[model samples]
Target chain A: MEDIIVRYISRIIVPFVQLYGLYVILHGHLSPGGGFSGGAIFAASMILYALSFNLSAGTKKLSHDVSSVLESGGALIFAGMGLLAVLLGTNFLGNRAAGFPLGIPGNLFSGGAIMVITFGVGIKVASTMITLFYSLIEGEGHSHD
Target chain B: MSAAAHLPALTVVVPLFFAYLMPLLARWRKSWCAATTLAVLAFTFFSSLYLANRVMSSGPFVYHMGGWAPPWGIEFYVDYLAVFTALTISGIGLPVIVYGIKDLPHELKEGVLGWYYTLYLLLMASMLGMALTNDLFNLFVFVEICAIASCAIISIKESRECVEAAFKYLVLSAVGSGCLLLAIALIYMVTGHLNFTFLAATLPGVMAVYPKNILAALALLMVGLGVKAALFPLHVWLPDAHSSAPSPSSAVLSGLVIKIYAVAMIKLLYKVFPATFAGMAPVMAMLLWMSTLAIIIGSMFAIVQEDIKKMLAYSSIAQIGYVFLGVGLASHNALLGGILHIFNHAMMKAMLFLAAGAFIYATGVRKLSQLKGIGVTMPVPAGAFAIGAMAMVGIPVTNGFWSKWYLALGALDAGKPLFAAVVLVSSLLNGIYYLPIIVNAFFSKPEGAVAKPGRLPAVMTGTLVVLGAGCIIFGIFPSLVLGLVSRATRLLLGL
Candidate 1:
């Protein structure tokens, strides 16, 4: 973990990795990659940072409490969007009938709630991966002590 | 736009919606998380009741998810059987959550209780979804959700044994999921459909053309669900998982979660497979033998267990056998008995587990031998456990009696008197294991100084009392449940 070349390389690479993850998540409606893969890509960047630096550095970037909140927030966003349709007197998760403006199909904002849901999912998956990594690694240290 | 039309979707979504909010609410106020969970489950319980009423009065009701019609999109199908199963799930869930409020703090470490509640709600939602969904793929997805949530709850205690048990349960259940996914894939390959009704309509023709493929799918589905349901030989993972889990988790996993898979299996056999296929395959005969073994062997194992929870876990394996026996008999009375047993067992087992949890919470004694004369000290839970045991033994005027009666009658109706004998002998075996626990708890001398019973929370005691009273209420007024079971049986038999 103390190797200079590896740390320097990861420091340079992590930002681009994270940018690509955001791009995949935002463009999910128009392309194949979506929330799950994008979220994994973003999580991988944090994991790389943890590997190059120490666990404490990783925690400084995304603390446990914040990651937990983000995890729940993502799920809430998805469920809230679904409930909006029910509140609007359509079926649960009914998209078109919920009165959200559906833009042109090929555009970034075209799919209305789909894009919102994918964004929520992206946040959730990324946070979940980080949280899981922290717990497993932190648990290992505790057991050793 | 009728409110009734949305009940099916709401029954599942309401609990799921709350589950998502649980962690956030816990971050704000831990008590709010528990309150939200209980409130949503209570709502789901009533929604299931209203849906059951609608199904009874107006026949089956179907809700297309997102307004997409079936054969393409997911559908929520609420038949007599589905509503009955959903009602049992949400009904049991409400009380378990109420019981959990007092019991969980003892079982879980600080700071992780929210996640436990989250998993609990998710488990309930997925079980309800599994019971109600008409799409084969949707059912598989729900099964996976239930599997993961159930495993997480088991490991929540964070003891070495709990973690090990959860790992074993995960691996075995993952295998079961694989089998189920493969079976669904095969069925879809043959018919190009995943909706149950559409598959049922198309399956007869596909079976006629490719009998072997249909049979393979049936076998895989049975084995897959059988593992999840802990059907006798496939139940090795169940005892450790159920006994080592935190009390309410054990209660839900043993009491309600295992039963839903059986319900799914029954739905598939009766609704999807044609009578000709059932007759040709010897599937019923195979189930008949497997269940008979499950009954005798599961009880025999229970008889030797020292740990009370392990004994109860083994008893679940036996009780599940009775349900499958009813299904395997495939007669009007037997199928009715099997379906009814699902409801009855849920009540009795959840009561027993919660009562056991109360006992553990009070005295921290889990061994039956250590429980000597403790019943005299802790009378309420002991009394409830007595009722559960009596119900397990099929005593007259207890709920278990009626299910066994119908199952025996079913065996007779099916011209299988040997199976009736098996049922009788199994009841006697049930008496052997259960009677001792009751007797030892009340009558035997305390081995050491009798530990004074600690005060139990009202919510915990109240849920036990209600479930205990339910055992007798349902037993005395069998008509309350018989009407639904008969209708469900008739639907299954196409009568």
Candidate 2:
């Protein structure tokens, strides 16, 4: 990882990779790309950063504690949304029946709880990937640094 | 809007919601995390009871997720069978959680307790979902969730052996999940429906046209669920994973988790497959032979094990054989016996594991040799273990006796006296392994310095007592569970 040229190139490219992931996550309902792929793409940016920099740098960027909290928080948000439907006197995870506003079709906010769920999933997946990578790498010595 | 209508969804969502909060609560207060977990499982237990009562009285109730109707949306179908299985799962889950409150701290590392509770709740929810879902795809999803959660909980022990066992379980179970998904895909390809009812309705026509495809689908589903259920040949992972897991996890894994897949398998055979197809297929006969081998061979393996947990783990494989044997016979009485075994085995096995855990917690002894006369020191757990052992041996007036009696009768009814003989021989085999442990625990004198029984937790001791009593109560009043099993079996047989 001491290759300066490779590091420089990754520094230039990582943000774009992350932006594309965001685009995919945001447009998940409108198109094929959604939470899983977008989250993976975002995770790839972090992984690339770790490779270019070092394991410690990656840990500094997204510590284990932060990632764990985010992972649980994403799941909680999804479950909480489902509970909202129940509290609203409908079945769990009910959308329109739960009184979530469905906006115009093909719009960003059109899918009611779908968009919210996708957002939660995206966060969850991205954090999970980073956490998994960090933990796996942590076992091996960061001798290169 | 009524709470009754919400029961189906709430049964699963309640556990999941609390599981999501577990880690955070653990961070705030460790005791709060355990309390919440117990509360969540208790809620699931009551909801399942209410749902089961409703199903029995009013017939099946289907709740479509997100207000969408079935054939297009995920549905929770609570029939006598589904609710019956759900009640067993949540009912067993509550006591195991109560036991875990005292037992887990000894097994898991300090910081991982929250994650353990979290995974435990998730496993319970997935099992409930597996029981309740009418959609094949949703069932597969729940199966994967249970598999992953179960593996994670096993690995939570942080021992090298625990991690290795968990990995083996993961790889094998992943293969099982893949096979299941492929089978569902094949079925969907032909029927163009994933909902069990819709598939059942259309399957006869499809089977008439493409018998081989249907058979292949059936075979794949059997092997897939067979691995998950720990049906003899595919059960290489069960002993290691169950024995190495933390005791409460082991109790759940051996007692309730494996049986849920068996329940799913029964649903597929009797409900999804057309009656004619089910009757004609040699799958049941094949299952009969495999289970016969499972019964004899699994018992033989159990007989030689020195480690008590490993012995019990092997015994589970054999007990699972009896359930499959019932399925294979496909007679009304045999099916009833099998269904009853599901509940009976859950109680006995959970009690046995918790008692084993208490022994470990009190004296740190896992080998049968070391257990010698330790019963004198810890009378309650030893007494519970003895009751569980008697039940395992199919002693009269124990719950296990009734199931075996009906299964033997079913074999006779099916004109298979040889299989009835097999059941009898297996009971003897069960006695050979189980009785010695109880006898040794109570009678044999300790060879070395006897470790004084440590202060066993009240909750842990109480769980064992309740389950031990359950073994006898259900044995005497088999009528309580038999009514449900008979109704479920009648439905399965389309009688």
Candidate 3:
């Protein structure tokens, strides 16, 4: 039954579901869903794929290397956003009036610090969730043939 | 315009960001790996020193995050105490990593070695983060990270006892974190602000308006931090956990982790809470009594222990009591003495743990009695250990003496000369247990021992020598670290 879900639903649903997750992340600054919520949703897409395929197959597709890089890149980008504020002669994490347009308050790119922080949270949640999934998989002694 | 204002946040970020980077670089060679960690720690250590110097020259450095300024965003405030903990964290952290480089091969296999370094860096980063963060909420987050990392590292050996110890640590820490979060949430309910300084600003209004809830939050916060600090009765898990972990981790956990929590408690007391509380003295007196008992009882426990590392682990509980006693007394000089002792103890304890690691590596013995004659063969490590023990026992010339001197003086200043007397007696007890190994190793020979020190590696001795030098330098020139402590203590006492 699990295999059937993997073969039938996941193969078809994974792509669209992940795209939706991305939408949740990008729209986080404008709406309710931000980095953590979107990242969790994105992870749900991959996790479903893993459930359908076996652990090794799932891991191979979403490898440790990818997760690590994503994690580091996400954090670096978060920090870079802060540095950008600093370079603009504002405070270290000052977002508004530091060059980037704050946009309208109710719009998509509305809140200054909120948007950048959302992206930071997005990267962190995505990579860390994946890492957690991998560790749990590895810890369960996932050495299937 | 000065760096002091932002120093607190940067102190946390540098190590923390390094922590996140380290695991990704895990596949690198051991030498390069150790070098990278050392470089990060050294960077952090210097930044702390620089910040401390700046704060001393200027005053408390306050950075309002996101430019929202205080009461809205978090306030990263660096006075003397925060800077002192920053220095202590990186100060001992670098040596532990240095000492770990030589001892790693023996404790861990090549495949999983990288994990050790990653977790070690995370532990360092978290401590630094916890030390410097001004947001009550952020402190909880960092404490969780430190807890998970330290728990993971403690069990790196895969031994049954290690697992059990780590498990105990995890459960207790979870409880502690829950209490801490609950308290912070309560504070938020009252003031709707998460920044400590902001909370302090509004606490009186909140308290005068609603006394019961504020007092309840205070109680919760104290209990939460008390468990983490391992205050006397709350310290059941510390000795076993410290003793069971591998050597370098044992050093970091004993010498740094609990002290940082104590610093946090000190911050909460003087910085956030109004000292004019009706029950302040009795509460402090309770802490004073508990810490005093912890010292004497901890030392007494140490005397009976045969396992060398276990003895030292118990000794740490006692030494921590001294710091607590000093701080709990509430006198300016007493607090200074306590804070200064945190630095002094880190150096001396790190030296002893590293030397123990060296001896463990060479002669393959851990019991103090079994280690009878290895000192004759391995003079450098033995000598290093002796110096550490002497410093720990409060010998007149060592750095440990200065902290003890200050503690004793502070105790006298607190008008409880008996506390000073207790410290003096405890120092003697410290000598009684710790001095024997040195004497036995050097002066009296044992029946069965290693023929000679079997190629004691340059790296091993190098770390030991550096720590030993720290003990001497800090001992003789107590003023060096005290300069940083006074600024911190001044803020804490509002003097």
Candidate 4:
């Protein structure tokens, strides 16, 4: 949209939206929201930015190529963490018994590999959302911008 | 535990790990996509072999996920049946993907090629997971994965027909998934356990109290899995989805994907449900009647189809009936015949589809009439098609005969000579449809496009050769697979 008010508001509000998403992802083990929800929330900020501006501006911010790489990388990281447990002589995706230090139960870093997995999932979900949106829009006969 | 203790998990995980990497590799190292896929599938194949060897030597074993025990944690049970299924999937999947290596670029867009590999690997991992998983929820998860991946592969061709067929498959498959989830919920309500072993142990106790719920669950399970397995009347989505798909996809879907659900159904029916349950008779009878219909109708439909893949797709519905008929018969030799048919049919169908793909790739023709004298120009694919046709007809010395032999024997053993007659009639039907294709290809003179086709890829032809050989070799030595299938039969029958 060409309107000043909408762009101004989105510019100011987007960063905080991203911050909340990160909070949810980091605290996934301690609280309710985890990778999927947090990542969707994170992606919403970018989607808002894209909506307020033009497709070109959105593409400039996160190109399709970069988003795809991020998508694959996120899943790879998740699988990699599980493989790490297997390498540690524990089962695939083994948690506390795999010898990672479990901080206080309610602490931010206490869930061993859970937080990391959530982080990977969050990144994956976010990029996947962006890619999905972009592809759908691209598939249309004309770009709105 | 040693690293050797991890083969079961590794068989699935390795493919999943590579699937994630496929798109990335496709972008930066475009050439690596197919090679990486091959390598990943090769790993799955060999590991499946290793697990089969281990299961044969030591009997069945279970592996706990994340070091947690079952009833709480997910577990993979490597029984003779599971290993047999795993072996069949990986064995056939490896060659199909090998064929896809050359065939895919011709069918799909340049950008989606990497994603195709991703979908193929995901499908592979999910089928392996379906085979080994002992948890109800885990099985559901794998089933969904397999469903989505299979659909994606079909629609990746991006043709109008492909997209339409995929949508139909997606809708029907989703309904099937919902039914399965509800059935699992019902089972959990009564038994209070998601693990197969725990469910089996507690189900009998609850059966006397909640007979209706148990029966409802059984009915839903049968319909749910039945739809996915494309059992008879529920197979509306299969022909379009399988035929419109890329050839490699057709090979996998008709060859292995549908069979996995049948394996899942067999597991639930034989392992979890108490054999002496009061409702067993009606269920088996229902299965017997449904399969009889599927066999006859599927073959009759095949006879009328002008499109080659469509005909093959219809035939699959019939072939799957043989597996179910064996299960429905509920005798030792019957179940043996059913289980053996799985391996035999997988080889035959995969080879046939690949051979069909080879023809389309070269001649760009799909009509049955136009394939005349195809044997003269494209000897390898045409010859492969001939062998596949013979196998389909249950001609002696082809693998198809042995399964039919057992099914017929099993029917007689079960005191149901009628189904044996049905088996014979279906074989005749099979010959009626399939034999004409061979005779026309080999005996008739070539015309326009069929006269001189494009060059066939070595890899594609080579895959056909291997699959065709597999049909004959396994036929000549039924004992090779019979040992496992019989053991699986004994285990299922609790003999």
Compare the candidates by lDDT and give the number of the best one.
Answer: 4
Among all windows of 10 consecutive residues in model 3 chain A, the one with the lowest summed lDDT is: A83-92
List TM-scores for all candidates, in order.
0.98, 0.98, 0.93, 0.98
Off by over 4 Å in 2: A142-145, B449-451
Each prediction's DockQ against the real complex: 0.66, 0.77, 0.47, 0.71
Q: Tens digit of lDDT per residue, candidate 4, span B1-495?
A: 777788888888889888999989988899988988998888888898999899899999999988889978999999999999999999999999999989999988988999999999999999999999999999999999999999999999999999999999999999999999999999999889999999989989999899999999999999999999999999999999999999999999999999999999999999999888824539899999999999999999999999999999999999999999999999999999999899889999999998999999999999999999999999999999999999989998899999999999999999999999999999999999999999999898999899999998899999999998898898899899889989999999999
The residue pairs that clash in candidate 2, if any, are none
- lDDT for B61 in candidate 1 is 76
Q: Please identify model 3 stretches exceeding 4 Å from their true place.
A: A1-7, A10-13, A109-117, A142-145, B1-8, B28-31, B278-281, B446-449
- Total clashing residue pairs per candidate? 0, 0, 4, 0
The candidate with the higher DockQ, 3 or 4, is 4
Least accurate 10 contiguous residues by lDDT in model 4 chain A: A136-145
Model 3, span B292-313: residue lDDT tens? 9988998998999988888888
TM-score, prediction 2: 0.98
The candidate with the higher DockQ, 1 or 2, is 2
Local distance difference test values of all predictions, in order: 0.91, 0.90, 0.81, 0.93
The C-alpha local distance difference test score for the whole of candidate 4 amounts to 0.93
Q: Sort by DockQ, best first.
A: 2, 4, 1, 3
lDDT, residue B202, model 3 = 84
